[model samples]
Target chain A: MAVSFSRRIRSLAPVLVLLALCLVIASTNSNFLSVSNLIRLLSAAAIPLVLVMGATFVILMGSIDLSVEGVVALAAVAASMLVANDFTSLDLGFVALPAAMLLGGLLGLANGLLHVRLAIPSFMTTLGIGFACVGVATAILGGFTVRISDRTFRELTLGRLFDVPYSVWVAGLCVLVAWIIQERTRIGRWVYAIGTDEHTARQVGVPVERTRILVFALAGVFYGLGGAMSASQLGQGHALLSQGRLFTTITAVVVGGTALSGGVGSVLNSVVGVLVVIVLANGMVLMGIEPFVQQGVQGLLIILAVSLALDRSRLAVVK
Target chain B: METFREYLPPVVLVLLVLAVGAIEPGFLAVDNLLTVTADTMTLFLMASGATFVIMMGGIDLSIQGVASMTSCIVAALLPELGFAAVPVALFAGAASGLLCGIVSTRLRIPSFIASLAISGIVTTVAYWASDTRSVLIAAGDRDSFLAWAVGDTGPLQNEILVGLVALLLLGLLLNGTPFGRYVRAIGSQERAVVASGIPVERVKILAFTLSGLMAGLAGVVMAGRLGSGSPTLANEFLLPAIACIIVGGTAITGGVGSIFRTFIGALTIAVVRIGMTFVGVSVFAQQIVFGLILVLAVAITMDRSKVTTVK
Candidate 1:
């Protein structure tokens, strides 16, 4: 009973922290509780929420994907240009969304292949790929912003259903799909097995290499959808479209009680993590803290969260 | 294969210089070569320090932040403290690195995440210290104290001389010191080092401190050269410095590299960067080239047998 109770509390810790932060922020600023502000907060979290979901899977496999910002930037640029846009004559409309995601998936596939085939670490592979993606995005943009002029496409960001933006709904659907993949799929089980112990997983007949590749590709698809959402939200796209999202998304996944060592936490945990980070940022802004200081707080927060979430007993070496 | 791998970096350096010189004859001119050597000083400084960490099978992503922060400190304090600010900045850099070491070693966090988070914190501190703008050195100070960095002595720039001196000292330290041997051993076999009863944690901390000190020195020289400092001063150096280490044939998995190899690597990067301009490659495309080079180099040079799983 004691062991189970302690385990239950450990699982509930993130939610407890979130509630505590909300209550404290609400006490300090009454407007933080406003429904309109809450909606605004949720909308603001829409993009990062999507990004965190994708990163959660990669991190779940004990491999990191630093390609989020680059992939998102590329996807955003591609989506902006492919849809009814000022930069080019191409106008695929809704088709542009899937097309952008396809590009992202391809990039993700390359990342996985390079990591697996070459036997390079995932972080290094993703980091290099991310840089290359940024370069490609920049080259394609040619130093110009591609603005979405289609009102119908822009409605994905602007239109509200039950006072929540369509982007939020899209993010919600992604969360559901990601959660389902995490909890109800054979690939998801393989991801956990590999992350827990790759040699053991392979010995148990898990298709480790294929699963790793597919997980990265899956992450890319989410990043691609995120790029489309970002384009819709801002109604424009450039090479820097996904700036700073990488830090926030990774931080959110870690903070939501997901271990960086992997095989722990779930999609729902990342959702809560995204909300925690978003709420903290919003609350700090309302409290008149300097934006620079907020960045420092976030840095400290990640360190603290990772330290808390880390299970040190399983590893002989931390590095 | 072993002999070829050993000779690859120098051979690549000579070939790159020859290739670029062939395309742009002016690139080989004595004056242009001196300029390229001087241009590589900052990257050489950063990469040489990072080489030690990488040699120990760890990495220090905080060097860029440390460099930027130290530059900000030097720029902000130069008028009042003048030459004293340099040491202050160096101390700050060392302390920042020490913090990373403690967080990683004591808290048992991975150095990658620890250094990355610390980088964010230091960068913010830099932004706050500079009031989100560039801080300029006074004209009087620039001519008086800062001349040591920018002024040329004989045919070589003072910056080049500074880099050479640092290289010599670092080479001596790596080859002539017990600490150096321990660092290499720890990187190659941590379990063996621990069994040998060596104080592994202290050595790791000291290596990080050395990395931070070098970053600080780079920042000071950069400030002197630019005549101003901002939080973004070294923002572009991180990837290139990593490129320098890997392209120079330092195994990214650690334990098989030298500062001299990084020296050659830095020159190669400098040649490639400047040569691209002469060859009319778009500035935007250079990043792609560096990224591809990093992946390819790591793929080629990685010690695959070091780990059972490539996480």
Candidate 2:
């Protein structure tokens, strides 16, 4: 396909953002150039990247996901119990990752079902679902921690391959898979079409309802996977995993230059969005800026980035 | 359709509470009910505030951050501020809400993203200000906070009274005032209102300002309840506050939800939360139930034709 200059810019967005972040980090600290830190950066970016990848598909379809964080906490706590450490060798929480994924998928599936089937607005569906999911997670743990002790899963998350962290590998594979699904599959085409125009897409024979449900379910898999891997890193399941999920995922998506208005973005956009967010956090850490201030600044930056990138032409009014 | 459906959510909530109480004998107790009501008030403040924003079809995500920040601020400012603490804490929260509104309306960023940004900024600022610790209300100020927090002028707790007062004031403003009508009109159709010569921008800005004011009040009440200001004190209230509004029958798409319904919504949330614990529902299951209820609430009460698409 011949790409327009604008389309090219949209595609190049992630690279541009990554390069810009690199230059800024390099300028702020010479030590940022070290391969060790670079890998660490990639790893740090990976978690949010997985999350943003999940969110981007929803955003591309012109909706949102606020439930990932809640699901993550539920999933992470589930993962924590499974690692076979202090809690129990025969852990259901460990199996809870798939359960969490199923739960998350069901939640997302609900979001899509309510969205297309019942016609509840996407914003409302996800918001309500996120709350419900978090409430359930808290109920399960009773606000306590579920620790993971499985050496194998921990190694899977922490272990390195060819000097690369496992997190990076997992995140990279996810991105690749996401890209393939977005570009090559029939489902992918339906997704793009729906985001562009739900009615027109439906008229053109896209299974809008089926595609949306699938996309939301797909997002659940990421949240669940992220939750599961998070156990490897922390060895505990805490419902806190999803605390700032809505803000962070949306921020990363916009930072990667994805339009909040839907129909125009890529998996690479998510990769870059997550990278930029992590870069900002990591750079702030390196600069010794207070963590709280860093959060506030990141929040402000997200608003700024999205405002700039929003395609107002496509939106008669933004809600 | 609107008239009958308007009462549906509250009725459902009443029935749900009755159901929960019937299942678990412990849920019907007064002392337990009072505490739950107190907890509900904190979110009620935020929901009442958010109702204004929602009526304008704009959502505010800063309720949690502002509440958390105000708790920290009140605790930190106690030595110098004294009884003046109430105004200052409320001011701080509202200011944060105002900033969010400015970011959304002036910059043309959507309220969802704008408020999300504000939540981030406020949470961070609160974290920094509190030095990542809860700030204790000084000894001299402790009595005053107690009076506000636990004092009983009569049957209701002080904080609960304040919430009721807020509810009355906000309800009147939402129903009886021109501002209220404009808000509803804005929610129904922004461009139409603008075309009709209403100052859509000002209405929006004011809606957010009102939201901020309510959050500020909530923060103060929350501080009183905790008896010490901690950033995390009101952090947990975020989901519940929004949930209360949604479950109270407010449209996530905006222009349709009401503060009156949200009042009942807050009560519903409180009852569900406190009742579930007493009913022997596990905490994790409670969280799941909260999420599930929100879906159910929105599913049943939401006006789908009003919004052309989700998100």
Candidate 2 second chain TM: 0.93
Model 2 residue A233 CA deviation in Å: 1.3
What is candidate 1's DockQ? Answer: 0.65
Off by over 4 Å in 1: A1-3
Off by over 4 Å in 2: A1-14, A91-107, B9-39
User: Per-residue lDDT for A3 in model 1?
Assistant: 80
Error of 2 at A318 (Å): 2.4
Q: Put down candidate 2 lDDT per residue, B153-240, tens digits, no spaces.
A: 6767776787778889998998999999999988887778878998777878788878877887777777766677777777667667
Candidate 1's residue-wise lDDT over B199-301, tens digit each?
9999899988888889888988898888898998997587788889989988878888888989999999898888788889887788788888898999898
Fnat of every candidate, listed in order: 0.60, 0.80
lDDT of 1 by residue, A1-319 (tens): 9988987887898999899999999999999999999999999999998888889999998999988989999999998888898899988888878998899899899899989988888888888889888888888778799989978878987899999999999999999999889889999899889889899999999999999999999999999999988998999999887877888988899889988898998999999999999999999999998877766777788899988888899767755
What are the DockQ scores of the candidates, in order?
Answer: 0.65, 0.64
lDDT of 2 at B122: 79
User: At residue A21, what lDDT does model 2 achieve?
Assistant: 79
Complex DockQ, candidate 2:
0.64
**Candidate with best lDDT:** 1
